[model samples]
Target: MASLGQMAAQSDMVQGLNAGLRRVPPWVLYLAGAGWAGWLFYLAATGGLGVEPIEALEHRYGELALQLIVVGLAVTPLRRHLGVNLMPFRRAIGVLTFFFVLAHFLVWAILDVQTLSAVWADILERPYVTIGMGGFLLLLPLAVTSNNWSVRKLGGAAWRRVHKLVYPAAVLGAVHYVWLAKGFQIEPLVYLGLILVLLALRSRPKATRLAR
Candidate 1:
């Protein structure tokens, strides 16, 4: 158990951290994420991302989208359990996740598949592609409504209910990754396991809730 003074210090530190976070606007993340994505594209174009630059770029963007999804899912748990608040940045994180997902799809459709018919064919014939496309479609509505105007128009409870699409979207993303990987690769499985664990944590009530 922590002493009163130690606990007080920790509380002060968290407050200070949150205060500093508030000073940073969410648009900062938007600019940084866009810049990073552009840099990755530049690297791929310049042959700096290995021999299979297009494939590498697609993987990078897809993996980054997954990471952002995980981070978005983590915000509530972190605030509820660890006393760390990231609510201010959750919308930005979500928007970036959608952006990266779109980028990943564009890379696959234009660079990898290279044909409209073949792209549609893959989505129909390939299970992984089908699943990934489903995830993307699910995110599309959420992304479109990720604004104050939509919230005001839809109302709060309705907005939240629609946003719950993220839950299944996230699971589909992990499953798509696992299905897309070759052989018995552990990396994709690790991502799937992490996503499942995060979902489970999100579903479970916090100690404070139980106390109530």
Candidate 2:
């Protein structure tokens, strides 16, 4: 446990940090996300992503989506425990996460599979792909409703309840990554463990309202 003085100092530091964050618009994240995605795509196209550029690009996008999911989940806990508020950027993070997820799917479907029928077959036959698709489907509704108008229409309680879909979707995503790995790799397991820990943290009594 932190002493009162230490906690106060931490709080002061967090306030300063959040003040800096406030000066930056959330749309900046969207622009950065778009630029990063374009850069990755360019790398894949120009042989910068190595021999198996398509696979690399697909994996990169999926990994980014997963990382962003982790970030989105962390915002609440960070604010509650450390007073490091990130509420303003959470929505942008979520939307960008979905964009990366969609990019991952497109790269796999268009560049790797190269056929609509094959993509369908993979979704049905491959357990990992099936899990990933399920995660994507869950996020779809959340993404659609991630707006002020939807919040107004659904009511706060209903909107929060619907957004809870992220929990299961995150689990499915981690599981998908674990299953998709060629062998007993440690990296996917680390992501799964991190996600599980974050989810466990969320199960605790809420010190603050969750940010969308």
Candidate 3:
């Protein structure tokens, strides 16, 4: 699917979006992420959630987390391939992704399951939960190291090496999504395939074209 970017490039939307984005302070992106979660909560509080609200909440959280993860993964590609700069928001993107993942886990463990024991039991018995938890754990260190302090402490190269854990973490996230879906759903598989392609793109070596 073509992103809004592609559509906007061919229309007036790009200018409007860029103008709106410029008017917002850099820090406000954090608030936007928080506001999104708040809106979801508001919906739930007001009984706006559908028949299977718990599932809906879980799906939304996990999906947003994955989408944000993919966003982080796309930053490099956008810069390298399209010359679009998203570097400024990458850290916030990562942090918010982890927040959503944590929220999803909490929703499952508290609101849905309603017990620590059951949470533990589900973690042990459910493959999807196990994989999802593993991915979340992998993201923990990256989130912790995202700040300038950790970058200085670990050295830039070493920090980058450690952060490479995100590749596996993203892969595991997709696998968890696929396993959790009922029957043979194409959506999760599509996400997995897209992740694979993005990772492959990242792995390729850059080359310069020779003069004719």
Candidate 4:
């Protein structure tokens, strides 16, 4: 197996993507996030963000969030199996995952439902919404403690325990997507399979026993 850096270098997809992404300063990622939120707002104000828009937005956001979660899960495996250097970007990717999940929930609550009462009812009555909310809830603590101080305060073991919620989060997220679609579909199934495999890889004895 190739090292993480070697893996990154070998793939045109990764290389091209990282080449453009590397040019972005840390502040630019922040700005990009703000820009995404602003654009969503603009689309809503212009009546471009309605049911179909919300569906599209949430679909994309959910996909991105899943990818980030998977990437975070892959870090240890990549480093161990491939001898990759993935530590530096792990936190950033995790943070971005949280950000996208937040946006996904916001778009659903604000743009799709447009009322707290409606959102509340959906959470109560809708299985998809409930599962989605559960996934979001799982992400909350991880997002809040992404910083070094929190890690130090919580200790690595405790923090790792909290972060393990990502596994359930991913499972819930896939179920949410499948329920939302109302039927079996290729895309959601593919993601579901990928997430399961990634999770299984992380759950192996060697991976499981490795200390953070």
Highest lDDT, which number? 1
Q: Once superposed on the true structure, which residue ranges of model 2 sit more than 4 Å away at CA?
A: 1-5, 206-212
Model 2 lDDT at residue 187: 94
TM values, all candidates: 0.94, 0.93, 0.85, 0.77
Root mean square deviation (Cα) for candidate 3: 4.8
| Model 4 alpha-carbon miss at residue 199, Å | 1.0
The regions of model 4 sitting more than 4 angstroms off are 1-52, 205-212
What tens-digit string does per-residue lDDT give for candidate 1 at 1-212? 99999999999999998899999999999999999999999999999899999999999999999999999998988888778899999999999999999999999999999999999999999999999999999999999999999999999999999998999999999999999877999988887888888888876685558888
After TM-score superposition, the amount by which residue 186's alpha carbon in candidate 4 deviates from its true location, in angstroms, is 0.8
Kindly report which residue stretches of model 1 are placed more than 4 angstroms away from their true locations once superposed.
206-212
**What ordering of candidates by TM-score runs from best to worst?**
1, 2, 3, 4
Task: Evaluate residue 36 in candidate 4 and report its C-alpha lDDT on the 0 to 100 scale.
Answer: 73
| Global fold similarity of model 3 (TM-score) | 0.85
Q: List, residue by residue over 44-141, the lDDT tens digit for candidate 4.
A: 55777675677767666777777777777787777666555466677777788889899888877887789999999999998888998999999899
- Worst 10-residue lDDT window for candidate 4 reads 21-30
User: What local lDDT does model 1 show for residue 100?
Assistant: 98
lDDT of 4 at 70: 76
Positional deviation of residue 171's Cα in model 4 after best superposition, in angstroms: 1.2
Q: Is candidate 1 or candidate 4 better by lDDT?
A: 1
lDDT of each: 0.94, 0.93, 0.85, 0.79
Worst 10 residues of 2 by lDDT: 203-212
